[model samples]
Target: MSSPALLPLCLLLLGLAAPVLAEEAPTPAPETPAAPAAVAPALERSQEQQQALMRQLPAEQQKTLQAGDESFLALLMPAARAKAAGTVVLVPGDGESADWPNVVAPVRQQLPTFGWQTISLSLPDPYDPVVAIEQDTAPADTDAQANSEQAAPPVTGGSGTAPAAPTQAEAGSGEPAQAAVAPVDPEAAANAQATRVLARIAAGIDLALQQGASPIVLVGHGTGAYWAARYLAEKEPAEVKQLVLIDAREPQGMPPRLDATMGKTDLQIADLVHAPGAAAQRRKERAAQKANKGYRQIDLPVIPGDRAAEQEQTVRRLRAWLDRLPPAASGSPAAS
Candidate 1:
């Protein structure tokens, strides 16, 4: 009934009202699922335990070295004699502190008595959750198999015919077969860890150089030996004149085993192995010796009850070996 001239004004009013109506309309709220439960950080727990142990170390002997953003704990034992022959940088194996209970701590504390300064390092833990999770799930699969066997009727003898192959659906559904399951690669994580460890070792070596410890020696116990040998072979540092490995063993998932590293390097190497059950290690060392003329292999007797005597014998043998090597150039500092 409105006039034609009012039509344009009416359309404009309706257009403006459309937005207002929309603004008044309520929108349905988005659904959010419940939050996940909190889980404790395993790495933090391990660090806390190490920190507690570090705090208990002697105030004078305990020292911290910066490696990237993280600070590593080190224990320094001065030589007992007036003039130190040379400094020995000790690297402990996995889950071992600067002053580990076994070979690491004993060597560090006792070597000082023989006129050699010792610096021991605390290394990272070897625990890998990816590997552990795979191992834990294995038991559950075994239990399921046992249940299936018990549920089936017992047969006096096995049938001549073989069981039928699994269907596509059966194979794909539920938990996958052990052989079908693809294990998570821990190589990246392990490489990162190795890098961090090497940084710490370099820092320790720098400190020793600053202290004027010439003709420096790198001593590694257990898997620590692998790290030490690898460092010398890879870096080819001139300051480190000798490499000593005590019961050296390669770490799992690490490339270029102990023997491979030893064989490639031309540095003065003393490969010490604990007798009995060390046949493989001995054979590897012998092979390396053929390639490296400077290599020397020493077989150490393991005394079960007399640990003190065993360590003394070890120190004596190490001292004799060091005495045979040419002394550092007179008036030459290690840093140079």
Candidate 2:
């Protein structure tokens, strides 16, 4: 039985005590879930390497060419002579760049001096499931390490060590924790790569046409040769007059064999084979079987440990073959 004035003071004291009690016992915060792991794309490594190479190339030669929804870098070199002979579009194979040191770079660079403009295209990576999986798993591994560190419990008491993280079984989950990665489809991947490559070639050809470069010639090295021949067989563009293949090779797991594609195309072809290559011999036989009068095989002596000499030899042969060609026909852009 307190007095009325004392009653108000007692209520005020209780109000203050309520906050103090709450401070003494706080509500635990909700635990945050771990972040999902990062998954690397199949093309990530190739694209990164291409970007690095792009930086090293001359700024004036750089050209951004669009193919479908994607845009890739190319190098456009104008002919050195006042009167252009023709435009040679160069395509490089897998694990190679537009300025590849071997056939692609030497031919692209040297051909210009002989009055031929050159356009070099960058190709997509060939699909390799094992390589793709290994490359993609690296990012996941790094993300897992970060996740483990972040999910670890804070240090407690005298031990000064963080408490062990709860295993899936310890947390009452029967299944093991895993980062899920989307599966890549092989056929779909191949089709996508083919589409991109063909689009790029078409774009390059269109560029050559706009610049009024006549008698377009497609030059391919390694697997790049396969794509060039395929383009000729499939598209059958009226502008292209000749084809050059340097150590032609078909990409593994892709359709339409190189020899088979070459047989289907009706353009003049020069098959430059580095000696001792059995594959080139087989390709020559197949072309002969098809009775392709326009096809001819030229042997290049392999100069081991002397790449410069080999490239020079190749360039000299190429120059002679090109010089032998009859000048562009009457209606050609060069004549116009």
Name the best candidate (by lDDT). 2
What lDDT score goes with residue 1 in model 2? 58
Residue lDDT tens for model 1, 1-336? 669979999999999999999999999999997988999766644366468767787788877888888887788888898888788899888767777777887888887887888888777676465674565454445534544444434344465555555544345564444332334446666677778878888988987887675668888988899999889878877778688888777787777677777766777777787763554455356566566666777878788899888887777777777767677522234334
lDDT assessment of candidate 1: 0.74
| Backbone clash count for every predicted candidate, in the order shown | 0, 0
Tens digits of per-residue lDDT, candidate 2, 227-256, equal 999998988887886888888888877887
The TM-score of predicted model 1 comes to 0.67
Clashing pairs in 2: none
Residue-level error in angstroms, candidate 1, position 322: 2.3
Q: Which stretches of model 1 miss by more than 4 angstroms? A: 1-40, 43-49, 127-184, 276-291, 329-336
- Candidate 2 Cα lDDT to native: 0.80
